[model samples]
Target: MTSYRWTMHRVYDATGNDTLGPAAISMWWLARAAAEETLQGSPLASAWLKLFRSHLSVDDPYWFRWAEDLAQSAELRRAYSGLYGRFVARALLSAHLGINRFVSLKRNGVVIPGSVAVTRISKGDIPDWIAWDDRASRHVLCEAKGSLTSRDFLAPGVPKCVKEGKAQFDRVETTGASGKLYPARWVAATRWVTDHRGGTPATLLWDPPQDHRPFSEDEAARHREAMTRAWLDSIAPGLGWRDADELLAPDRSRMAIVVNAEPGPVPPSQDWPELPDNDLPLIARLTEVARLDRFVAQRRPVPSDGPQDVADLAGAQSGSQTYQASWLPRPRGPEAKPHQGDYIAALATPFGLRPMRTRADFDLLRRAQDRARDLEEPAMIIGLPVGMDPGAAPAQTTWLDGAGISRKQDLAVFDLRRVKVDLLDSGPTG
Candidate 1:
């Protein structure tokens, strides 16, 4: 399976030491994080999504092959290295440290009040990304660097990158809504190599002890509103909306989302569970293969088992059932029958967003849409195969075990140790 091995470190004065855990992360989650970071509300979101869908692989060494091919062109190689570096940094910070939302330094500097004056440093010295940590109630800054060079060269070069990133952070400043400076942490993430088995990403985090007030309730509200807008904008295309404005239109009758469930026997409704109402709008579980036909046509490298292997990996086994469920909006005043168009039947699968062609498939979705219109309060329909109990756990499979990781929906993470950490200054082991 394709994955990135990562390690975290803390730098004190002139010395650096490894922090607790090192691990491997699935490319699926990394690609998802990259999409959130760069494609939200972007004019080119569709194109970027297509690119990611084509390149991402979970059960093959496709990334290494892609990187090797790109290395033939110096310009493309440089661009890929920089972009991949930021993606890795975002993935690690989000999955490991719980910092999810991110805005480029350029965007944040302009949008946040009073940031322009505080971040007037030279363009080259600005940090790469800015994020808020609701758990810690503090802002986080990150500067990411990447290289595709040999290990001999990277041994010396990685520390220099970290040093320079720290210098950039030293020049940056930010403030919360009350006009007082907000507490912040700094991180410098470096992926020293790409296209090689030995390459592993590393981070240099400098979180000094400091006392500062958290964002006020009003400040948090505004921040949440902005982040929510960005999230909606990012997934608008995937949800078949023209844009965020159209998706958020007050008069719009239906809200649509595409959920990409993991490959395994379908679990009962109780095991799967319904998402909370507040999270419904943000509940898109995108899969790596948005369309299998297109994926095969591109002739991307895969395991020797060929297209069937790809199908299994993408959760599209033959004879597998597609299930649709609808959650109807609450009614008001005297109850009147909802219009036929008012109902929306969305499925939980990784397949392409297309109409079901089979007679049974068509009838199931059509009946679901009709039933939703008859409800008074919000209601959900859970679809299960004929033989399964409504409360049974999903059947286990050897696929995940073969990959050497625990499954969390489509996400898989594995711990690692003894990975090398080359720092300029020697420090006592932590």
Candidate 2:
């Protein structure tokens, strides 16, 4: 560490999110990777991304049943290693980078198609972000913490990630401006967690060992040098400190810094914000952080526009475009239109789902779930066929696949925007 100048910049997120700390920072990285799309004509722009999904997930019930029993008595480990990382990482990365993704680190750098973040530092490591820039042929290392020039610190639970900042200054050396002055350095623990927006950014001139008087520049230099060595030796001995600068520059691949990366899709939304999201990555990530009950309770995808279930078939359209499906038990007559109020409604767009004849629609004879969220106590008169046997065994469901014909679900839940209201079938199939 020679005579160096530290540069820090303050930027606001597009969503006005303040807590851009660890989990927020980390998850945003994942979200961007999840969102990026490969160009069609630009061969170089096409980078393959492989989405890795862990078997151990937050959505699984079996794990929590015996999570406490997961012994670490011997050469063993906690059951939630991957899960903790997933939750923290996902939470951190997206913590700050909301819909706009406004925090651009470098204006010009190589855009690695499937670039990877290397050596994930702990909650407070100086270099948490170490990723390669395939385009610039370099590796950018970033040590990010919120600005600490605050007159007051955070209240307990005011900013959740602030508790994790305790480790940032521990075992780290400090310096003062002169031998005559007391040594001082900005400590994350004492400062308020840098969330959303706050005081203007100010440069801190670190000082040496404590005293009442100020020291000369020469004294500050000596303190900085001695403390720098101690800082490196104690905190980041393995950081390859010597070649850090080289890796941070373009054409620095000559330095040995290798990160394993996998191939994945380049979504159209990556290029066009207005485009629809594939959300495969988000679905995979939430598997780690989602509550088990959420899956069972909703029993469906929450993001209305996300990937549709195979059983869902053709999902709802932006407009009220008519759709057709090879429905089960077949329609008895021609059109079965009930009162408008009889339909299971949605908040955004009214979901139109019905014509379910049996359990064969979703596998089981009795689970033909036609129950409404609120069935008006009795049931809305939805024009049931005459002589209908509610106790009759459900018909076997057969999934019919086609782009030529659109498919609609037999039922609709809360997400109206994503619902595929199965309406009247084509005529003359008696």
Please provide TM-scores, in order, for all candidate models, with all chains considered together. 0.49, 0.21
Error of 1 at 25 (Å): 1.5
Tens digit per residue, CA lDDT, model 2, 1-430: 0001111111111122111110101122332222211100111111111111222122221111111212235222222322222222222222211111111122221121222212222333432222211111222232223322343222112232232333432322222222111112111211211213232111111111122233355443343333222222221112222322321333322221111111112232221122025533433343322222111112345445443222111121111011111111111121122211112111110121222232232222012223322331111111111221212211222111110001121111111111122322221111
Candidate 1, after superposition: displacement of residue 143 in Å?
2.3
List where candidate 2 sits over 4 angstroms from the true fold: 1-52, 55-173, 176-430
Determine the backbone clash count of candidate 1: 0
TM-score: which candidate is best? 1
lDDT of 1 by residue, 140-253 (tens): 666766665523211222355666766776666665445646435445354443344443333433343344565677556566445434434444454445554655564333
Runs with alpha carbons beyond 4 Å of true place in candidate 1: 1-21, 41-69, 113-118, 150-158, 192-211, 216-222, 230-246, 250-430
